[model samples]
Target chain A: MIILSPLGWLGRSTLYFLAATGRITLFALQAFSHIFRPPWYPRELFNALMQIGWLSLPVVGMTALFTGGALALQIYSGGSRFNAEAVVPQIVAIGMVRELGPVMAGLMIAARVTSSIAAEIATMKVTEQIDALVTLSTDPMKYLVAPRVLAALLTVPVLVGVGDIIGIAGGYTVAVQSLGFNPAAYLQNTVDFLEPLDIISSLAKGAAFGVIAAMMGCYFGMASGRGAMGVGRATKDSVETAAVLILAANFALTGVFFSL
Target chain B: MIRMENVTKSFGQKHVLRGLDLEIPRGTSMVIIGGSGTGKSVALKCVLGLIQPDSGKILVDGKDARGGDRDAFLARFGMLFQGGALFDSLPVWQNVAFRLLRGRLKRPQAEAREIAVDKLRRVGLTPDVADLLPAELSGGMQKRVGLARAIAADPEIIFFDEPTTGLDPIMSGVINDLIREIVVEMGATAMTITHDMTSVRAIADNVAMLHDGVIQWTGPVADMDASGDPYLEQFIHGRAEGPIEAVR
Candidate 1:
């Protein structure tokens, strides 16, 4: 065997890393192909809806409530500098509807669901459950990835819509109590500042973020290395990738909505 | 009726299979023996089309199995995984009847549950275990569940990957007898990969030894005792000192 020095070892490690990334990309492509095929699993899709959608609502709602409350406080503190406290209603309404609601929900899901999906599937993989699926003449991609991606696509927008409403209500509560704003007038101003375009944009962001998070989780899980250490690595990597990608996509989407 | 022609598979720089060829005749049990990472499992997977070979032809019943109708081709085979690979989220009956519920074989829930229960009974499990999750079962029970699932569909071909790994001696013997009984009764072709000599003695009609990315020796089970290849002798005896290196 050719002995590798420290520098050579580093180089070899980098090469292996790149190769694994390429392999993962290829696997993702194969999975995507199954999406366009027939033999869809309606039951699997329903199960995913329960896992990624209904079960996730409480966490998403709670995160939105607290974030909305905090945003209102921050805006009130900043707006007082210019006697611009009157702008609080429009700013909070617009901010929550356009960015904070969807982004916060997406990040929270990245923390909760992404790591969970990755760890669960990665462990199944290490233990050879995926091979059993193949032997049973079942496509694991169709059974595992399709339902998840579809659930993420369909449910996240709904989650965002709910988050937006709860967030606006949170802002309303804080504005009325601590900021000495009239309840009815604050609500009206909040309503006046919001547009159909802002709501659509938030929902759109939610769907995209949801798909990215699930895809990252499934991709990392299916490509996980051999043992418990490998499954742990996959979970961490999936969450990190989902969080970073959500932020990046959020920025790009913001630029898209606001630029033109 | 499985045939592999000059099959080779490589993961980057390391070659797992080097122009390997194998055939399992119809209605016979062929056991492939090898140490870990010796590509025994990979070869079985290639035949199942779970892993595509780099360059080779795999035929099941004289048709190209590699790129044909994958589901249909797979439907003709059953497999018992080394780890019993049952779906933890599903109950035992659903796991056993997975294919029956999902594909063209879709049946009503009640019927599927009944079939699943019958299959469980065939593996000596009770109907009460049907509603329990795989996680609730012991390792041996889980293996039985996996075995029950494998034979539930009663395919013409079966593949068993280390069917006796991580089991007590009595449980392993039970599993071996179960496998033998199923293969003989159903008149199905079987391909088994294991390092367990006892399993080979219990289940194989023909034995093939895989080492160094190729079949080192192959013969009828009766000839295994006297074939006299040093490598085969060393492996069958489980000697620490042998020409076979311990690395893989």
Candidate 2:
């Protein structure tokens, strides 16, 4: 019995994980269907967009700026060992556009938007506002989850695009002002090194990450237990799950776009 | 009219409602009283189709509650939740006019607001409170606002869950009287669930006692004191030494 205990624990954990994954998939599919259906709430959708997109700009922009500068500095320092310091511009541009920008923006959003969505929705559930919506003949899925998911889906990619440009600019400022690199030459190298596929992959990854973040938030929230503790747990779990899924998705999307 | 026959619900092994049978005739008020967790809310949810029963039938106006267009079915009902459950994001008037501003009952914003204000006035609230958020209101005021919202659409049936749970005696009495007046004025069928004896007395034409997942006693409010059922006697008299186990 002692020896089998470990196996039993593993089996239970695996089952729980599978069940959670299935529930999330079903929820995502339902929310997605509602997005295309009638009885849409434009006011709710616009509110979600403002909250998840317009409100998220400063943090995403700042993170990208600092990250790009640090990337340029690191590449320059390492390349100097091999007398290849000139590779800094190309590497920084490619790095920011192909990988760092979307992932960073996604993680930031997971921290900001996912936690906010989870806490808000879980509180609503606990307070019976969700039930109130149902009694009023408003489907919570269409009024709440669909609007949020759609907003994140439409806006996160745009945020990613913006982040990539800001990141490249950060690298440019660092290289030109502090590293004694020629400004025009640095810009040329940066632009020349980035392919169209790199930009597309970045934006695509952003969309996937956005959906995961919003879906995890809504799923955890709808499944939240009762009381303040339940709301707190939902918010924490949502952010953690969104962060992990965003990173995993970034890797998978990278492979899809660049493996061949 | 609403009816529940042989309704049973269980969460795992804990049966909340077991073989429950109940009926509420049109244009009458029925209040179910019970101890906490005695399936009062569960039965109500089953009737509203918010929760499905494991076995049994629920009929609303002689039609199966579970079948047909959910929107149309829901349109006939209004619910005032226990905690008031006003939308925190919307203003008082918007919350009150929620039903009229959207869906099949859609109306112009101006018309909806006007109706909301009129309902508020009927519920003893001022029109000045319209633009304020629900959080700004006191608990009693919030309950009144919820009541206003419930009657805003002039639903044929209204359900009040613990209508005076968190209020002082005077406020509770006020709310109880308002509920009674509103139901009578609209000629609407009403169902309320609460353990508050005062509220039960004020709001019920017919009274039902629920215990052990079923109706233990039921009759007109006049016969409640003399019903002589151990559960009903124990619950009404607030005695801890009767058929109910206090530790539960």
Candidate 3:
């Protein structure tokens, strides 16, 4: 019985995971289809864009800046052991543009936007506002989820581009001022090392991560149970799920873009 | 008119509605009164298509409620939710005019706002309260705003869920009177779910007592006290010892 119990528990867990994945995939497909349909709420879309994109700038900027600086310092120290300290500029540029910038921005958004979206929508569900929308002849999927997912999809790429520039600037500051590297030579090395494909992959990853973050928030919210505990759980699960999915997606996207 | 025939719904092991049957006539108010957790709200939600029944037929105006253009079907009805359910982000007027400002009922912003103010006035709110968010309003006022929003589009049918659940007796009386007056004036068919006998007395043209997932007693409001069903009698007198078991 004990050995069979372990198998039972594993099977139950696996089924639960599969069911949740199916629900989220269906929700994402519905929201994406609604984006192409008419009767779109421009006002709601604009509000979402401002909240997810413009409001997220400061945190995303700070994360990328610090991560860029620390990446430079770590690479320089490791390179010094091999007498390869001069490779810092190229490595920092490639690292920030290809990987760190988008992932960091996505994680920051997963923390900020995903939690907020989940809490707000879950509260609405608990209060019966979602039902009210349906009674008013508005499709909650189109009215609520589509606007948010679309906003995140459109703006996260822009945020990634901004983050990449800011991150390179952070590395430049650390290398030139503290590490005694020449300013013009460092800039030239950094610029020369970054290819257009690196920037495109970063922004592409940003868009994918954004969709995952917002979709997780909406899915958990609509599926929330009944009260304060339900809202809290939805918000917590949304951020955790979004962060993990963002990391996993970053790996897959990187493999697709850069793998030999 | 709305009718539910043998509707059944279960959430996991707990069956909320079991073969529930009901009928409400057009241009009349039907109040369904029951103890908490006896599936009154579930029945109401089923009629509105918010919660689908497991096995049953729901008819609105002799047409199957489940088969039709959902939006067109929904467009004929208005609902005032228990907690008001006003959008926290929108101002009072925008919330009131939500239907008029969007979808197939779209109107110019100015015209929608004017109609919103008119509906607000009908619900005893002033135009000055139009710009305030729902969170800024008191609970009773929020209920009034919800009522205003419900009738904003002049829907043919209106449903009120727990219209006086959380209010002082005076406020409850006022809301009940308003509900009764609005139904009469609008000449709209109304269905209300509540446990408050006072609300039932004030708002019902016909009353149905729901217990054990079925209608226990149903008759005109005047015949209620004399109908003499044990469940209805116990519920009306507020006695705990009866066919209905108190959860606690």
What would the per-residue lDDT of candidate 2 be over residues A214-243, giving only the tens digit for each residue? 989998998888999999999999999999
lDDT of 1 by residue, B149-219 (tens): 99888889989999999999999999999999989999999999999999999999999999888888999
Ranking the candidates on lDDT from highest down gives: 2, 3, 1
Task: List candidate 3 stretches off by more than 4 Å.
Answer: none
> What's each prediction's clash count?
0, 0, 0
Which portions of model 1 miss their true places by more than 4 Å?
A1-36
Instruction: Extract clashing residue pairs from model 3.
Output: none
State how far residue B6 of model 2 sits from its true place (Å). Answer: 0.7
Q: How close is candidate 3 to the true structure, as a TM-score?
A: 0.99
Instruction: Output the worst ten-in-a-row residue range by lDDT, candidate 1 chain B.
Output: B239-248
Docking class of 1: medium
Span of 10 residues, lowest total lDDT, candidate 2 chain A: A251-260
Docking class of 3: high
* lDDT measured at residue A201 in model 1 versus the true structure, 0 to 100: 91
